[model samples]
Structures are given as C-alpha cells and as structure tokens.
Target: MTARVGVVTFPGSLDDRDAARAVRIAGAEPVALWHDDADLKGVDAVVLPGGFSYGDYLRCGAIARFAPIMTELVPAAASGNLPVLGICNGFQILCESHLLPGALTRNRSLHFINRDQVLRIEAAGTAWTNRYTPGQEILVVLKSGEGNYVADPATLDELEATGRIVARYAGAAPNGSQRDIAGVANEHGNVVGLMPHPEHAVEALTGPSTDGLGFFTSLLAHLAEGSPLAGAPTG
Candidate 1:
C-alpha cells in the first residue's frame, strides 16, 4: 500500500498544495486536512506547510496552535504515535503547541527574508530526514519574518547532547538563530519542526533544487518499515 501523508490547510496557509504535490512526487498519496477539522483521516504522517496562519496575529503561529485540528495533532505527535513535519509558520505552531521546544522570534535583521538557504543536516535519523546523510547540505527556501529560533541555554544543550538538532544553517545564520540552528526533532524523531520551507524546494521547475523531496520520501520509508504510525487508520 502506498503511504498516505496529510498536508494541513490552515486559514491563511499558502503552501498546502505545494506540500501535497511534493508528497505525491515522493511516491506517496497526499491527503488534505483542515485546520477546523480534528480528524487526521487515517494518514500515516502529517505535514504542516508554510504561510501566515490566522494572519499571524498575536504571534506567527500562536493562534493556529489552538486550532481544532491541533487538538488531535498535538497529542498524537507528542505521544510518538504520529509523524509530523512542520515548516516555517508550521514550525512556529509546533513550538506554540509545546510539541517542540524553542520560540521563533524576529529576525536579527528585522526583515522578512526570502531566499534559498543551505542547511547542514546534523541528525539524519528523524522520520523526516532519514534519507539525508549526516552533515549533508541541502538547499531549500527560507521565507519568514519571525524565523529566528531561540531556546534556553539548558534546553539547547540538551537538544544538542541528544542529537535532536536536525539541521543548522550552513556558514552564516540568515536569521541569527542561536548556534545557527535551522531545525529540530522530538526525542523519538517522529516530530520535527523546521524553519526553512522544504516543500517549496521539492521540484526543479519551481524550486531551487529537488533536495527537499527527501523529507517526504523519508517518511514513506519510515512507514514502510512498519513503524507504529503504520497502524493508523487509512481511511
């Protein structure tokens, strides 16, 4: 059976379709999920695409964290029963929901940055990054105003010690993120929050490179291995 990955659509999400397309391109079935709906539709994994959710009011993803859909997504992902990949605003939501650590603050430059960024994969064992080799650099789109990731020094040390740091900006930190971090994963590697937009870099025709497709393909491989998420409802 083909792996089914759900791409969530929030009120102001702008990359849901692109994310779904990337899933399909990665040899998996793409399912649409809504922010107002709590059901996951039995998907083996979920993708929270980029964009300004709820107009990014209050905070980038503060409002979206309380969305009806997140009620289900949070627990499932937190318990390691589901695999979730959050990008850009979705990353903010993951942090806001407490599924991931750290908060996305304003850029050091205090400007909305939009460009192709290079990231060095620090942990390739995560559900979304398994296809990448450790230390491999991949180029993906980075576009956001509040993309600087910050966490308490103790938490940062723990994340680094446990190999939960998934990726870091190569060379210079575009947003001035501490330690040049770009992404991180939960303890079990089932939940990941990335500031860069991988979904936007999955195709050559429309993206900087096809390197981002690996994130989607990695989830398919994880499901094929009969992970716990493989038992999820497939309806």
Candidate 2:
C-alpha cells in the first residue's frame, strides 16, 4: 500500500488543501484530519499547514495547540512513532504545542512579509528533509507576521550541537530570526517545524520552483524504509 499522509485542518487554516495537494503530488494519499477529531486514521505521516488558527488569538497557534487532534498528535510525535511536519502557522502551532523548541515571535519589522524566500538545507537527515542535500538552497514561499524564531541560548546551542537545526535563511533573514534559523527538527527527527510554505512551492505553475516537493517526498522515502527514527547526520 502507498503511504498515507494526513493534512490537518484547524479553524482558520488557509493552506491545508495546498498541503494535501503537495502530498498527492509526492505519490502519497492525503488524509484529511480535522482539528477536533481525536483520531489520526493511522496515517504514516502528518502535515500542519499554514494559517491563522483560532484567529491567531493570544498568539499564533496557541489555541490550536489545545485542539483535540493534538491530543493524539503530540504523544504520537513525541514517541517518535509519527512523523510530523509543520509549515508557517503550523510551525507556530508546533512550538506552542512544545513538540519543537523555541517560539515564533513577531517579526522585528512588526509587519507581515510575503515573498519567495531562499532557504539553505541545514539538516538533510531529518525525516522531512532527507531528500535534500546539505547546504543546498531552495526557494519557497514565506508569508507571515510572526515568523521570528527564538529560544534560550542553551537550547539554541543544543539544537545546533545535535544537528537538529534543519534549515536556515540563505540570505539576510527578512524576519530577523535569530541566527537566521528557518527550520528545526526534534531529537528523533520525526518532527520538523519550518517557517516557510513548502506546499505552495511544489508546483511550477504556482510556485517559484519545485524545490518544496522534496520535503514531502522525503517522508515517503522514510516510511518506505520503515525507520523508527530518521535524520541522523551522515559523514
């Protein structure tokens, strides 16, 4: 059977359908998972697409973190049994859920920036990034107001030391994210949070380039390999 990837839809989500399309383009079945639904439907992987969930109340993704679906997603992802990819607002949700370290704060400009951004793949070993080559640059869409990622100094150092920093801004970071960090992965590498919208870049007709397809394809490759954990750096 082909791999099944779940794309979650929380209230106010805007890119869930785009993510599902990207999954289908990557040769996987896209399963629609609602925020209030507690069951995951046994999907091999999951994608949290971008949008202002719960109207970005309190903070981006703060309310969505408490959604019933997360009740099942958090533990499964924590145990390294489920692979989760959070994009843009989805990235904020992951941080709010504590599935990944650091918080995405307002951009230093305090303005919503939307543009095609270049990102350098910093950790190609991660489950969502394994199809990429380390240091390779890919262009994807980035549209957000609160996209600055911040963490305690120690946590930042730990993430860097352990090869968990998944991607970095290729040029000067538009949001002023610390250390130009754009994405990161959990210890086991089954979970990743990216501030860019890869789903929006999977098709040439719509996106800047087809670079974003690798993120979804990587997960399919991992599922096929049947690895309990992925993303270990290779020499």
Candidate 3:
C-alpha cells in the first residue's frame, strides 16, 4: 500500500500539479483534493502547495483559510491526528488557520523576491522534516513578496525554547523573516510549513538538485509509525 498524499488545489493555486508530481517521485500516491470539497479522500497526509490563493485578497492565505476544505482540515490538524505540509502560500494558510505560529508578512524589501535560497535545518523532529538532520543545509526556490515571518518577541522565544524552529535561511535573510526563519512545526510535530518550495527543487533534470525530495520522503517515514489519522493508507 503506497502512502497516499493529498494535494489541495485552491482557485489561485499555481503549483498543485508540481506538488503532486513531487509526491509521486518520492514514491507515494498523489491524491488531488479540491478547495471547496471537504473530503480528504483518505489520504495519509496533505500538502498545501504555493500560489496566490484567492488572488492574495486582503492577505496571502487569510481568505483561503476560510475555504470549506479547511473546515475539516483545521480540526483534523488541531487534533494532531494529521500530517500537513504547507509550502509558501500554504504556509500562510497554516499561520492564518492558527495551526502554526506567527504570520508571514511583507518582505522588508517590499518586492517579490525570487531566488534559490539556502536554508539550515534547525530541527528534524517534525513529521515533515524527519529526513533532514539538524544543521543540514539545502537550497530551494523562494519566491514571494509577503514572505517575511514575524511574531511577538515572547512568542519567538517560546518557539526557540521549545525547539519549534525547524529551519532558517542559511545566509542573508532573503525575505527578512525574523531570525531568518524559513520553516516551523507545531508542538506535536505533525503540522509543518515553509516559505521555500521543496517541490520545485525535487528534480535535478528539471531544476536544481534533488535535495527537496527529502520533504516528501520524510512523510513516508512519518506515517509508517502508525499514526492515528483516520482513513490513512500506506505501503
């Protein structure tokens, strides 16, 4: 039974297909989920690929957070019974959904920054990051205008103390995220989100090195541990 990973496609999503392809390349079955449909289709995990969901209205993921599908996803994720990986716009959704801490704000540069970004894995205990060893560095494409991650100083301290800071920009803070954070996970380690796109970097023949493959592969190892996510099926 191959692991089934669901990729949700919002109206403005641009990389849903790429995300599904990356899941397939990582040896899992990719399941297509719709933004309005609340059915998860028995997937072992879910991925919210990057894009300008709802035309980035009001804020990036603010409006998309209220999508009908998120109605189920929210509770499922909050119960810590589901594994979710939110990339770029999806990251914004996670934050807006309150599944993750902090908010992705406008970059200090105030321009859409597109570049191959290097990131350091700060923690690897999350379901989506188990394949990466702490301190490991990998490059992936980062493109967004409102990509800076911010939170109150106290909240930031709590995250650090709890080891919730999963990854950070390796060198220059490309988007000026606080402390150069590129990704983070919930306390239970089931929910994870990142601004850089690992799916885009998964195929060497297509773009960069295959360093991003680990993100999807990591999910396989994550759910193989017999998590309690309902309807989950895995190889």
Candidate 4:
C-alpha cells in the first residue's frame, strides 16, 4: 500500500504543496490537510511544511500551535501512534506545540537568511531519516528570519546523549543554532523537526539537489515494515 503523507496548509503556509509533491516523488500518496481540520484523513504520516504561519504573529508558530488539527496531532504524535516531520516554520510550530524540544529564535544575524545549507545526518534511525547513514551530508534550502535553535543545557545534553540529534550543520553553523543543531527527533524517533526545508530539495532540476528525498522515503520504508517501530542508535 502506498503510504499516505499529509501536508498541512496553515493560514500562511508556503511549502505545503511542495511537501506533498515530495511525498509523491518518494512513492507515497500526498494528502493535503487543512490546519483547522480535526481529521487527518487517515494519513500514515504528516508533514508541517514551512511558512510564516499566522503571519508569524505574536512570534513564529506561536498561534498556530493551538490549531484544531494540532489538538489531535499533539497526542497522536506524542504517543508515537503517528509520525510527523516539521520543516522550517513548521519546526517552530512543533517546538511551540511541545511536540519537539527547544525553541527557534531570531537569527543571530538579525536578518532573514536564505541559502542552500549543508547538514550532516546525526541520527538515521528516525522514521524520517533512516534512508541515510549517520554522518551522511546533504544540502537543503534554508530561508528564515527566526531560525536559531536554543534549549536549556540539560535538554541539549539529553538530546545529544539520547541520540535524538537528527542532523547538524556541516560547517560553520548558520543562524547560530546551538551546537550547530539543524534537526532533532523525539524519544521514539517518530517525530522530527528541522530548520531547513527538505521538500524544497527533493528534485534536482529545481532544487539544489535531491538529497531531501531520503526523508520521505525513509518514512515509507518504516511504515511498510508492518510492525511497531524499534531500533537501536548510538549518539
């Protein structure tokens, strides 16, 4: 069966369509989901694509966190009954939703930074990352004004110690994210969030590279297993 991946379209979402297309490119059925819709249309997975949701009002992703869809998403995702991937502003939403840890603050540069960013896969066991080996590098588009990620020392330590760090900037960190962190997964590795936009890079002709294809494919592989998720990973 073709895994159905839902791409949410919030009030100001910019990449929901792109995410849906990437899912299709990865051989999964892309389902368009509305932010206000409580139902997820039975999608096997969900992607909160990037954009300035709620006009980035009251702070990025702050208002969108309480959307009706998230009421259901938060619990299902937290319980590991569903897998979720949040990109860019969506990452901010996940953080705001408490689905993921830490926070995405204003870029240290205080300017909107847009460019092709290089990131190294640090945890390949996540449902969204299994297509790559640890330490594998890939390029994805990153465009945001508030992209710096910050967390308490203890949380950062736990994330690193628990092997939940999914990806990190390959070189000098852009946006000044702590420890060069670019992405991370939850305890179950079923939920993930990142500052870069993978769906934007799933195609070579239009995007920087096809490196982002792995994220969507990885989830498909995980679902096809027909078993509960279980994997051992090292930090």
lDDT of 1 by residue, 136-219 (tens): 999999998999999999999988888889999999898999999999888878899999988888878999999899999889
Q: lDDT by residue for model 3 over 1-235, one digit each (tens)?
A: 8999999999999999999999999999999999999899888889999999999999999999999999889998888888999999999999999999999999999999988888898877778877888889998889889999999999899788878888899987888899999998887778889999999999989867788899999899877876543211110
Tell me, what's the RMSD of every candidate? 4.0, 1.1, 3.8, 1.2
Pairwise lDDT winner, candidates 2 and 4: 2
- TM-scores of all models? 0.95, 0.98, 0.95, 0.97
Between 2 and 3, whose TM-score is larger? 2
Instruction: Kindly state the number of residue pairs that clash in model 2.
Output: 1
Candidate 2 segments exceeding 4 Å error: 230-235
Query: Relative to the true structure, how large is the alpha-carbon lDDT of every model?
Result: 0.89, 0.93, 0.89, 0.91
Give model 3's TM-score versus the native structure: 0.95
Compute the lDDT of residue 157 as modeled in candidate 4.
98
Q: Residue 205 lDDT in model 2?
A: 99
lDDT score for candidate 2 against the true structure: 0.93
The reply for model 4, stretches above 4 Å from the true place, is 230-235
lDDT of 2 at 36: 95
lDDT string, candidate 2, 1-235, tens digits: 9999999999999999999999999999999999999999999899999999999999999999999999999999998899999999999999999999999999999999999999999998878988999999999999999999999999999888988999999988899999899999998899999999999899999999999999999998988888666437331
lDDT per residue (tens digit) for residues 114-207 in model 4: 9999999999988888889999999999899999999999999999998989999999788999999999888888889989999989888999
